[model samples]
Target chain A: MIWLVWRQHRKQALFALAALAALAALVVPTGLTMRGAFADLGLPDCVRTLGKAGPANNETCLTAFQQFNDEYQGFLLVGILFLVLPLLVGLFWGAPLVAREVEHGTHRLVWTQGVSRRQWALAKFGLVGAATLVIAVGYGLGIGWWLGPLNSAGQRNRFDPLFFDMQGAVPVGYTLFAVALGILVGTVWPRVLPAMAGTLVGFLGLRVVLATLARPRYLPAETLTFPIQGTAVAPRETASDWVLASGVRNASGELVVRGGSIECPPNATGPGAAGCGTGLGVEPGAYNWQLYQPADRFWLFQGIETGIFVALAVLLVYLAVRRIRRIA
Target chain B: METALETDQLGKRYGNTWALRDCSLHLPAGRIAALVGPNGAGKSTLLHMAVGLLRPDAGTVRVFGETPYDNTAALAEIGFVAQDTPLYRDFTAGELVTMGGKLNRRWDGTLARTRLAQLGIPPDKPVGKLSGGQRAQVALALALAKRPRLLLLDEPVASLDPLARREFLQALMGSVAESGTTVLLSSHLLADLERVCDYLIVLHGARVRLVGPVEDLVAEHRQLVGPRHGDDPIPGVASVVRASHTDRQSTLLVRTDGPIGDTSWAAHEVTLEDVILGYLADGDRPTSNEAWGVPA
Candidate 1:
């Protein structure tokens, strides 16, 4: 099924990848130049800089950094590819999932071929999932060179809320989430515009509402449980406070950080697909932070987010399968 | 006992409305059965259920005496040509054939190519570019190449023009005749069904209103020509569907098995169209020997 899905959308996948390649080519020179400028400075020799507190220098430096961040982030392009391109592609890609058959009333032909409804659904999902995965992996690899320089810069200036901060791996993750959502919407709702609009509205709406309502409570730091240094990673052991630092895509398509340092709370009914501390959330608690690293929190966040999105994706596929069964 | 296709009280419901009801049917091997129905008549749903695309809300469906769903071995014996002659709009005919060939174990690629060539449908041509008739032919080739024991179609001719529809149906009939595959096809046009189908099943309101050999049904059904005045008794003829007259002459569409006893009315052969209208128009059920058709 994934093979068919891959074949059907192979062109679009290649095109998105080609665009990513072009972006990489355009940005690699600038990244190299930034590396050269640092080497020329020869002061503290490539230390992460806290820029001087002067408006003119700050503006120019920040602008330069932002351009590099834009390339490394690639959210604007990747997100559009995942969210918007799919809706149009769903017209071509997802439409045949069942819509055109319904429109032409031709599903009857295939339905009678003795292949069960479940097998049919499985095949289509396999195909579309493969295509979406290929596009995502391409984005991840293509942007690696541009982002590596920044990581090597060992930059620790937290003031510049640039592209890489919010729209990094987070957007790539979110885009896959959107693609899965589009597949379900396209299959069930069927008509092109309505399916696209409903998907856009519903996805944005739910993610925003969840972010707004759940953001503060989800981080572990607010719970104030003492930072128990990785005690064998076992649950049911009364685990300590953990922080949830989120880089969320907002309604206007801008990436923003929602929470500061927060505490983790213990939830009994944790994320169904186990791992990466999905069960840990935050509220006002008894522990305080000593020195917390954002990278630790980043791991926990990505793990939880991946589990959540994957669960949601699996659920969407299940619903689509059921809907298709009932279609005939 | 091992029928090619059988349904035991098979029914499909869309929420509160029943698409098919009490549709118990059995098709033995090597019979070409035409499922005739009006639009919205559960024919497609029935076919879907037969092929295991849709589960029956109640009762059971089997192909080759085995449940089609989840029975890959059983499914291997069936080839379906869906309504509207559907194919992956993205694939060229050749690619699709290759895909189908790779997927099915019993594929006969040589035969498929020959059929495509004979039908004058270029395998390199994208199905999207082909005419409706040509696409239908391509679909037929693909299905035939599977070498299935049972072949199913749902309104495969609905999109084609009148002449193309006839040509496609002829080709389908020829295949069935040549191979002796058990065939079940659904359509709205009874004239074509009558032409090619040896067995007939009339579907309406999710029920099997009538089913039997076409010849038997036609032979037994007769239109009675009688005068208007007499309220005469008729033997062998079971029911009168409609009666009308001008002055002294009267015409009656009645169903009968043998010689009519009504002295006042003369019996005449009924057209297949009239017999079909009787079913579509929602009249009496035609018994095996009963014939109630009006001559036009």
Candidate 2:
């Protein structure tokens, strides 16, 4: 059974290897260059001292950080490749696993062999699932290593959706989910092209819904209140925190308006703007509030999201196995 | 005789229509049975059930007295070449043979290779690149290598040209002779199975219409020509399978238990093809003798 699985999917496995090598070709050199620039600019020391330094030294650190961001920001496009890798695995490797067999009527041939259909399905899923896991973990670690300098320089937050999805254990979860979804869709649909299309739509749709509607709500966001001024107070070390919402709140805790800025009279200027707040029926206790998930929750969030996706993958695989058994 | 495959009151349905219904028959050991029917006569359905590819909705299908559905032991003993003889197009013939060897517990790699060599089939060429006849032969070789006790073929020669059909059957017969395997070969064309099969099962309207030894089926059915009489029963003619009438002449294909003794009728011997056609034509009528509890 193992030999048969390899014989059937060896081409797809080779294709995945080539794709991984191609991705490596793009990331390896760029990662080295970014790391070199990080060391050259002494950005590591600068980031460590950013909030604690005197005004003059702080200015220098900000300038160095700005330069690093300007130089390496374009490389963020490589993250898109990592983002799409799992989807490609779903379509090319997973969608056609069972679909092509049924479409070509080869399932009838293989199922009637000495091995039962259930065994055939399990062997394919086991081998393919293990391969996806290895590839996804390897890719995730590679992305983590490549993005280390940028993330350390405080140019991008690890909590950001793009970076979060591409790094840590979540990519492995995504890959497993995508592959399992592809298999389940193919088993139910029994046509390669349509199953691939369905997998694409389902995977992307669930991702969008989860990222937008469910991620921020994974845990109750912490809120901070500060005096209303020219702008909301910038926390000393919030570079890695995910700010979900920030707005002005009145004394009664009702949101007066939903923005970091407060409008003032045209005649009011400089210090006079402080008095403008009272003219608008704003109480003296009115303050700005920021809702955020702290940087300390990064690993917690990764575990949560990974748990969600992995659970979904397991469910999809179970359903696919059940469906394959009942198929005529 | 030991039974190789048997189905009791087996039935299957798709949507609102039954693809096969009340299908019950037995293929004894070492007999090549022809499952003959028209295109929609449920021949494929029955073969699929026997191989456990399809689960019967009503009754049971057993191979060597063991239920075949999801039973690895039963599956190991049944070889099936589905319609069109589907194979992995990307693999070469040799690779397919290797795959078969890897997948089956009892494999005869030497027989597969030797047969392909004798047929002059290039083992290294991808099966998709082979001619339709070569593909069918490769499929047959793969199935034969399993050394299965029962081989079920569904419309194996339906798409082959006459010469290719003959060659494919010849290869199958050669292997069968060597293995003494019980074979159930299905086809809409009677001529394909007439020469090779000693037993026959005729399916029509998703039901088994006739089943027996080929010679016995041919012997019991005869065409009787006599004076036209409106719905009149004839002595020694047990049941009318098919009938046609002109102004003063009535010709009826009838099944009987004994030789026709009435001198008013001239009984002519019928071929296997004639018997099959008679049963198939009988399918279109509102009523049949089999429906009336007459033994088929």
Candidate 3:
């Protein structure tokens, strides 16, 4: 059974290897160049002085930071490739694993052998599942290494959805979930093209829902209040935190509106209007309030998200096994 | 005789319609039994059940007295070639043979390789590139290499050309002669099985209409000719399978255990095809036309 699985999926395995090599080729040189620029620009001192009043916040250091961002931010576009890698695994490796067999009627050939259908399904899922894990982990680590300088410099937030999805153990969970979903759909539908399409739609749909809706509520967000001055919010204070919501509150603590802008009453005189023109703190005792998941919770969120997807993957695989046993 | 495959009150349904219902039959070991039926007559359903590809909704299907559904031991004893003889298109015949060896506990790698070589099938060519006849042969070789006790084939020659069909059957017969394996092969075409099968199971309308040794079934049925105006029932005839009439004369296909005693009627021998067509023609018309000599 092992030999049969390898023989069948050797092409997919080779393609995945080639893709990994290509990813390494793209990241390695860019990473080295980015790291070199970080040291040469002395941006480490600027990052160290973040949120403090110091010489590192001076014009030269600020210009240096801007220059560093200008030179390397374009490389982040490559992250999109990593984003779709799990979907590719789901379509090519997982969907076709069973759908192709059934579509071509080869399931009749393989399932009639000495081995039971359970053994056949397990061997295929096990081998492909392991391969997907290795590829996803390798991809996550590569992206993590490539984005190290930008993340440390506060130019990019690790807690952001894009970076968070590609930086830790979560990619493994996502890939496994995608593959399991593909297998489950393929087992039930038994058509390669439709299974691939269903997998694509399902994987992307779940990812969107999880990232936008469920992620922010994984743990209760911490709140912070500060005087709403005329200036914009400081970047350093919210550097790596995932801000869920922000708004201005009235003196009685009712949220007048979301965001920092404020509107004065139409009959207000010059001084009152002038005060309102300076943004939300114009009203007495009102301040800017922010709801956010702080930077320290990065790993904890990663654990929670990964745990969710991994549990889903296990459930999908279990359903797939049960479904396959009843397939006619 | 030892039974190789047995189904008692087996049934299957797809959606609201039954694909096969009340299907019960026994295939004795070492007999090449032909399951003859028309399209949609549940031949494929019965074969799939026997091979464990389908689970019966009612009753049981057993191969060598054990349920074949998800049973590794029972599966090991049965080699099934489904309709179209499906195989991996990208794998070469040699690779397929090797795969068979790896997947089965009792594969004969040498036999598969030698047979393919003798058949002039290129070992390195992918099966998708092979001719349909060659693909069928390769599929057969893979199934044969398992050395299974019961070999079930569903319409193995339904899609092959005349030459390919003959060659495929020839190869099948050759292998069966050597192994003495019990074979149950189904086909809608009667001629495909008439020359090779000693036992016959006639299925129609998702039910078994007739089953017996070919020789006995043929011997028990006869064609009778008599006057159109006659008694309602004919003597010495166990059952009238089918009947047609002209204004002056009547012709009937009848099953009987004894000789026809009526001197006015002529009793002629019936071939296996005649008997099968007779049974297949049963229950196929409205009841209003079922009377004797009703011109249907």
lDDT of 2 at B292: 88
What is the per-residue lDDT of model 1 for residues B84-193, given as tens digits with 9 covering 90 to 100?
77887667888777766656667888888888888888777778898999889888888998898899998889889999998898888888788889899898787788
For every prediction, compared with the true complex, DockQ reads 0.30, 0.74, 0.81
Question: What TM-score does model 1 achieve against the real structure?
Answer: 0.75
How does residue A111 of candidate 1 score in lDDT?
50
Native contacts present in candidate 1, fraction? 0.43
TM-score of each: 0.75, 0.93, 0.93
What's the true lDDT of residue A315 in model 3?
A: 97
Candidates' chain B TM-scores in the order shown: 0.87, 0.94, 0.93
Best by lDDT: 2
**Total backbone collisions for each predicted model:** 26, 0, 0
Ranking of models by DockQ: 3, 2, 1
Question: Candidate 1, A96: how far from true, in Å?
Answer: 6.8
| Best candidate (score: DockQ) | 3
Residue A49 of model 3 has an lDDT of 67
* lDDT per residue as tens, model 2, B145-179: 89889999988888999999999999999889888
Global lDDT of each candidate: 0.64, 0.87, 0.86
Q: Indicate the worst ten consecutive residues by lDDT in candidate 2 chain A.
A: A229-238
